[model samples]
Target: MPTFTALTTLVGKDSAEKLGEAMERLTPEPTGVGVFEIEDGSGLWEVGGYFTESPDAAGLAVLAAAFDAKPFVVSELPETDWVAKVKRELAPVKAGRFFVYGSHDADKVPVGSEPLLIEAAMAFGTGHHGTTLGCLKALDRIAGEGFHGRSVADIGCGTAVLAMGAARIWPETVLASDIDEVAVEVAEANVSANGLTGQVRCVEAAGFGHPDLAAKAPFDLVFANILKAPLVDLAPEMGANIQAGGFAILSGILNEQADEVVAAYDAAGFDVHTREEIGEWTTLTLCHR
Candidate 1:
């Protein structure tokens, strides 16, 4: 196994709390990767993590080379090869009947069930983050009740996990969209990998700005797992897109932020049904009024 080094800087103890909060929000896993923090004499601090893999060397080199051009006194940690390390932890993850795999060349989706292989990027909703898991649980809850063959939309469809989940749960078709083209690409790939390419379609859209966004009108089911601020900003449009008595799932909220998120939708005329929590994250289910 090859071992590569990583470096992280900190801006003093004063920034520790904020940095810690950011880390928690980011939730960078430290297995195939490990993170450590460093403090400079001037109170500035740097935190870094390393990947341990031989195959990942090329990718890591590209990342390291890019950092070399900058003169922020970037510290270089001991070299570690991480290809094998990441691969070991990147094993296929099975959740219920759905299968989630990494993006490496060795990343292969299971033949049975639904296979969703996503590039292991820094983006959330690779079906590994807590928010993603909460959304998945919320999805499972909605799936138990069934889709009633109604249309659905997965807003902020990072990797289109929930959308794919909906497609797998019911034969009903779903439209998934994301603001990031990269995420959309990953989502499209995942949809095809899962054999639900025909059922769940991915598109690029900034919020509800997609040209085809309005065409899916008054969807019977809507799932939006985004941050609190955007969730509040989208309240009006969310109300407009969901049909009366239809269901909507909202996630990407912290425990303390749940009520605020629920209030946003409540004011928009959604009646709260249930709020699901996993770890520090929360997912709320509501019915359009």
Candidate 2:
């Protein structure tokens, strides 16, 4: 079956959400609709719809004009096996002491390296992306400094790879949380696949909203590989939740935006311990004062 997508961008979140709701009433009716804020410091929200049949161009144009959104760009996506493609394209990634690989490369685990198995189908945080890679390396560096995480949390953990990474070395159980329930499920699945069921706990929450995460406050180490805006917003809470002299491994920041994130954390009483750039992404290791 062929799939089609119609995408447009608008200035405000309200308008984007309205446009997404309107798309659900279209003739062919979108199979799914999504509204997301573009996180590049641009005050833009993107509205997109997916359909099994071709969308009605006229209806899309009318909605775009009504919402003051840019014209919808409709495109037909080729039917490709995305999982197979990921398996072929995503090779094993080695970050310091951690070696992340899929089952297909299970035989390639190196001696003396922490092995973290993340299937390609699970997608996020397979240790291939610069942000995740950088975080793993940062964790390795902290461990090398003789810092052991007694209590840890992986906020916005995608596949719980970072949590698993922490669990691999430390005896403490790591808590992994995500706002999306699906991501929590994926994280749990990955934890089991890595033989880390009891070592890593998965929960659904934004930031530290969940009870498990709240009760386990003042963590010794925290990993948040989310974007700049959220990272900035999370600083104050991060300050309160992390123990004095604890560590925070933060990523999902562009190289250009690293300064802003550092400034935010600095205000929260965190000193920049180390900053690393891999490709266009920057990872920060901070110490709570």
Candidate 3:
């Protein structure tokens, strides 16, 4: 398959964050599709955000039409290809079990003993994004403390990386949900691929407090790696769903946005547990009051 490049920028720093937040809504849905063709163990490939699947010739046009992006398809010299390009691009990220590449790296988790391999595609959760890594670290902290019989609710679970991490390290019961069906599908695939279907179940939910979630009230741990505004809006609901003394992990906030987000949690009855930062993003862990 031919490779493509989408080099678009948000209007400014603030706009960048807003754009990133908006793009998140498109994830876990078929908003984009990518195909990687490997030849001679390497080929030209691209990791672009797409809103729909169409003929290769039409992919760029579709992207241009659906979103404000500069989408252009590109190929390499006859011998050199996209896979090699991605490999080179991803090489620097090989520090841990997870390596995140590209601009959308905030949506995945790349931790734990077993390797979490996710191609940089239109899907979320490639272990490189700040939101994903921050949540991973928070999950690791919880797991390290030993989650014996705790119950976890992964809100806005995207690719279910947090759910899988909880299952891998803590053996806790996990319920992972995403607003996007495509995200749920990808999460299911990853969970199954990692042999975690029994511990983690992926489902679709518009947001917290959905009837189904209410049915599973009082989670020992609640994790949501969504943006700042939504986190604020869901604070009350999150506080209600978490059991007293349970842990709550919140992400998807830029470092500068951390305090405001944390205050929302505090006002909703969650006590500050710990806060960590990765690059421009921050992760806050709290205890439900």
Each model's lDDT comes to 0.68, 0.95, 0.66
* Backbone collision tally, model 1: 26
The lDDT-based order of candidates, best leading, equals 2, 1, 3
Candidate whose lDDT is highest: 2
Candidate 1: stretches off by over 4 Å: 1-86, 90-99, 102-115, 119-123
What is the overall TM-score of model 2 with all chains considered together? 0.98
TM-score of each: 0.67, 0.98, 0.65
Candidate number with the higher lDDT (2 or 3) = 2
**Could you tell me which 10 consecutive residues in candidate 3 have the lowest summed lDDT?**
37-46
Q: How close is candidate 3 to the true structure, as a TM-score?
A: 0.65
Per-residue error for 157 in candidate 3, Å, reads 1.0
- Answer with 1 or 2, whichever has the higher TM-score: 2
Identify the runs in model 2 with alpha carbons over 4 angstroms from their true place: none
Error of 3 at 57 (Å): 19
lDDT tens per residue, model 1, 127-187: 6677777766666666666646378899999788889878876787899999989989888
TM-score sort, best first? 2, 1, 3
